[model samples]
Target: MSAPRLRRVAVLVLDGAKPLDVGIPAQVFSTRGSMPYEVRVCGAAPGLVAGGDGLSYHVAHGLEALEWAESVFVPGYRHPDRDDPPPAVVDALCAAHARGARLAAISTGAFALAATGLLDGRRATTHWHYTRALAAKYPKVRVDENVLFVDEGRMLTSAGAASGIDLCLHVLRGDLGVAASNHTARRLVAAPYRSGGQAQYVPRSLPEPVGERFAATREWALHRLDGPLTVRTLARHAAVSPRTFSRRFVEDTGYTPMQWVLRARVDLARELLERSGHSVERIAAETGLGTGANLRAHFQQILGTTPSEYRRTFAKGE
Candidate 1:
């Protein structure tokens, strides 16, 4: 009756590191009974490293920390487009990869990962602002600017600081299974699983024409997801005509009101599949999809997997 050994994770702090980027992995993989990870915050050298947004980091370990780590995270730094990472830092990252440690980059950290030449043949992403620069600087790397993150097996990259959470949760799910990852996400108050392939940004009209106009209606719909809901019903709640509601709702959320409702239902179905043992038929009824066949079709179209298959992959106590 011994406890499981913890995985070693190192957050490699580079000069001009972004604070949120450094904090994401350090927080997600922090050692605790609930999380089976031991985090070490290290720098290029054991000293103060300048940071972005007027912050800084001081570490107790240097590149040596990567030697013992099972995973090494490179947090984004400022002005990555201005210069290459230090040669020794790049070498250390390459060596870590050579030794079978997973390497992940957040935001502009992709610049440093690319500098090591390990991402030459891999698909990667960075904060949208830097995607073109990242591609121009490293022609050999396949830079996909649209995704929230990309998992190229040993090397992973995320679009921005927030997506770093999605990346870490992804890694956690792989190591501990969906149930555990979901529990951790609940603790972090984050979304349980946002597919890495999901777009980093969605088109939304700015200055939101329907701002707050239908916020209450949306909230109302969420609570009544299992019940019959329609454009007319939602419009009634919003005190508007159906035609006006449909037009403005699309402009507001970048989705027809029905499209928004369907996505919400699918998201609810996913949660139920992971946490509950209800049969697909029951889940379909509860999510307003009406029948098992309908649920399967929607799940296939939206998540690329059937409800039963999703349950098998992510259901609790499986």
Candidate 2:
């Protein structure tokens, strides 16, 4: 009947840190009775620190915060091309990594991580504007400007500010599973999932009026996930041809209709496994996965675990 220990997270705010990047993980992993995370904001040394855009931060912890953290986030800062993070900060980050703590960076924070040499020969990225500088400065790092983020297992890096949300959600999903991550995203009003491989900058075209219309279709689909749902069915509900629906749906949500439906079903199954005591067969039927055998196959392929295993790890009151 007791809950698991909270996941401790630390936000390391370097000098000239961007406000949004610093705030993203702090708020996302906030321990204010809503999530299973405990967040601490720290600086190179606890005190006043200059931030980007004329803002300043007063952190309550210093590098010592990273000592006991399970995960440490390095938020992007200004002028990464010119200024290097304090040597002590870099050393502390290295020590944290050696202690098996997960280290993630946002935007130009990748620069600090790279300086620690942990990112050497590893794929990473930063804000598109600074990708060249990152590559030039840290030639050992395989700079990838195209991706929204890179998940090199424990070492993660994301593109500019907004993608920090994507990275945090990605980490949350890995730690607690899809159900908990989706709940957090809904609370934050952020997109539930965006694959790290997704492009950081999606090319834009002229505005289309049909964008908002598909949201209704998505909501409609969520309610009928246990029923027969297909691109044709969804397109019909949206009053569009399947071809148009498929094209526009990908543009709007970065997923084909069927792909989205399958992921949604998986998410629903995860919630059911965590919160209910139903049999796998019943859960499969309820989530429209049809049979226990079929559900296990999909669970292994998508979640890398069996339904029973997932339940054992995340089920409530176990």
Candidate 3:
């Protein structure tokens, strides 16, 4: 039998495009040895398109690429909710979706997809700052403000610039299966398979405690994960009453003492998983979580994957 054709993926560019948003899907879908894809970077106006970073892209293909594509992607633009595309561009987007072309948007790009009326009666999202504005402007589209991304079978929207990677990975997982998606994620040094339904605004930074006294106490807790580590123990180490230490800990680091300690334990366990051939039970004991089963539960709760799965994804020379 004749082989099936490679899927044609078109990325719609526009004036004032966010460069990262444009680059994400283009880089992601171009991974080889996966479901084959032919990526096209197109613009509505068949000429120069400027990006938010003061860079210009010479787009060779016009909106006609949309008509020729099997999937269509829209990237974020400056003031995307306010700077709506020309009627012709919107019509082209709508037409592509109507013809069964899978559609996706990154960050504020969701505004462009929603403007096409294709997102009407469909759940969508944009950057957290603009989600309210997007919903107010297009009452017909269900603007879910919290998720990293939304995948309504063929239509998708992502929350922010980095979340664009998450959404693209989600689309890849659906099309190419877990193994291929994992390979691409490893190549890019990205987290594969983040829950698209999770809140988009989870903070990743845990800065060092502000004051020297609390800093030493934090370090003390770090070294004692295998020992009894109650709030009082930490307070004693800091030379303060438990109540005083708790308040200072929260003020200095924005997390409770125990929370910080738990995070440290998890971090150590994760490093062991990636760096050593240690068993999960041994790693759990080393980190003071006690057993493999306990570590598995907490690891899944925090990282959204089992310890062994994470090891497989990050192990050296894999």
Candidate 4:
């Protein structure tokens, strides 16, 4: 008997679909690899679909193609005013779900999925800009505005434009394995694996200098992350009392000194995991988080994944 066929993924491109959003899945899933996936693009009808940028896409299949898919991905379009998807499109999605096909939406494409009622009672997300509107319109759906994507067992929704790449890579990782997904990421020159729950484009608040602070102290703390440098140590570096340093640190960076240190250590640990071949123990020690056990704990709390798993999914090579 022949080996089982690869899973079939159908991308539904509607009129006014943003070309970038529609193209991400096709590019990411169609690469030559050990874990290959069959990808197809479908439209309302088998004809040229106009993109939001005025370019026309030659879609060879129509909604009929969805019947055989193992999964369906819907890309976002430009029209937010027209909250409803065409009846044919809605029917195709509902029918596919009824047969146990997984459904995914990228960016504003979530609006289309939400319209089908499949996302009802499920936690999902979209671009922060449209999150409130999506919530108001679909009160049955639990909308989280901060995440990159929400993976409900059978359905998923992603955030804004480039976030589509993040979601597609996540799905690839989950379906294939870390190595195959990393290969695809290298081919696309994109970050192979971003933890799904990472915050999407949250602006970092700049630290304001309190009473009389200097850049010297901040740099000093960075150099001593692996040691026991507390708020008192930082205040000493700045020639101030620990109490004064505490208030000033928050005013400048919007974070307490320890919070800032933890974030910095996490960032350093991530860099080491991605760029170096060092063991988890060494990485943890160098970043000042201590042993591998401590590193794994912090990684899980901050990144929603274990250290080794993060390395496997994001490391440069095998």
Off by over 4 Å in 2: 1-3, 195-318
The stretch of ten residues in a row with the least summed lDDT in candidate 3 is 196-205
| Cα lDDT of model 3 by residue, 182-239, tens digit | 9889988998966423331333313456666587778777888887799998898888
TM-score of each: 0.64, 0.62, 0.63, 0.63
Report lDDT per candidate: 0.86, 0.86, 0.82, 0.82
User: lDDT tens string, model 4, 1-318?
Assistant: 876577899999988888888999988878354656788899999999988987778998999879978989999888654657898899999999999999999988999999999899999998767776899899999998767888998799988878888888889888988887788788879887565344313322123444335467877887887888788888988989999888878877768888878877877788788889999999989989999998888776666667777677678884
How many pairs of residues collide in each model?
0, 0, 0, 3
What's the CA RMSD of model 3 in angstroms?
7.5
Error of 4 at 74 (Å): 0.2
lDDT of 2 by residue, 191-298 (tens): 886533323132211122335659889889989989999899999999999999999998887678887888778878888888999899999999888998988887
Candidate 4, which segments miss by more than 4 Å at Cα?
A: 1-4, 195-318
**Which residue runs does candidate 3 get wrong by more than 4 Å?**
1-4, 195-318
| Candidate 2, residue 154: how far the Cα is off, in Å | 1.3
RMSD each, Å: 10.2, 12.8, 7.5, 7.9
Please give the RMSD of candidate 4 to the true structure: 7.9
